[model samples]
Target: MGRGDKKSKKGKITKGSYGNARNRKAIKAKLKRTASKKTAAPADGATKQKRTIKKKAEA
Candidate 1:
């Protein structure tokens, strides 16, 4: 059978598979960790300055 004609016994939809509950939870947890890392404190003045600039632009 061709790829498009094949069926998954697990009932998964290939496109936008993150709609699956397990996948969605995993993705959300990963994003939370990434966002925390990004917003973590800067070690030096230059990085803090850049962050202030970004916040101002966002505001």
Candidate 2:
């Protein structure tokens, strides 16, 4: 149950492998960041307004 145990955090680091103990929060945070980037609103408000205007004109 120490450094050599595969399920423990120390062992995962020693073995250079990712598991629940070693990378859970890091993985979750990374996923959240990417998801937020994908779904985030545009930084420039003008671009969004332009897109809406074009859509309304096309409709």
Candidate 3:
């Protein structure tokens, strides 16, 4: 039987009581690191333009 303090089959914490708190720490660290990264913006003269979605046709 799987224990509550270890990772479950799908790699999630089995209990909500800080049993196996490693998952929480790892996820938080990952989020912090990812949030620190700065994404590059499109160049002013690039071919990219604002996108628009097509309207749905009347049934």
Best by lDDT: 2
TM-score of 2: 0.40
Q: How are the candidates ranked when ordered by TM-score, highest leading?
A: 2, 1, 3
All candidates' lDDT scores? 0.55, 0.82, 0.57
- Model 2 score (lDDT): 0.82
* Candidate 1 colliding pairs: none
lDDT of 2 at 18: 93
lDDT of 3 by residue, 25-55 (tens): 7778898878765354456846557899999
lDDT of 2 by residue, 1-59 (tens): 88899999889988888978988789789999999987877767545344444445665
Cα lDDT, model 1, residue 4: 38
Better of 2 and 3 by lDDT: 2
Model 1 sits at a Cα RMSD from the real structure of 11.0
Cα lDDT for residue 7, model 3?
52
Q: Write the per-residue lDDT of candidate 1 for residues 1-59, one digit (tens) a residue.
A: 22232243233334334444336678789999999998887677465334444445665
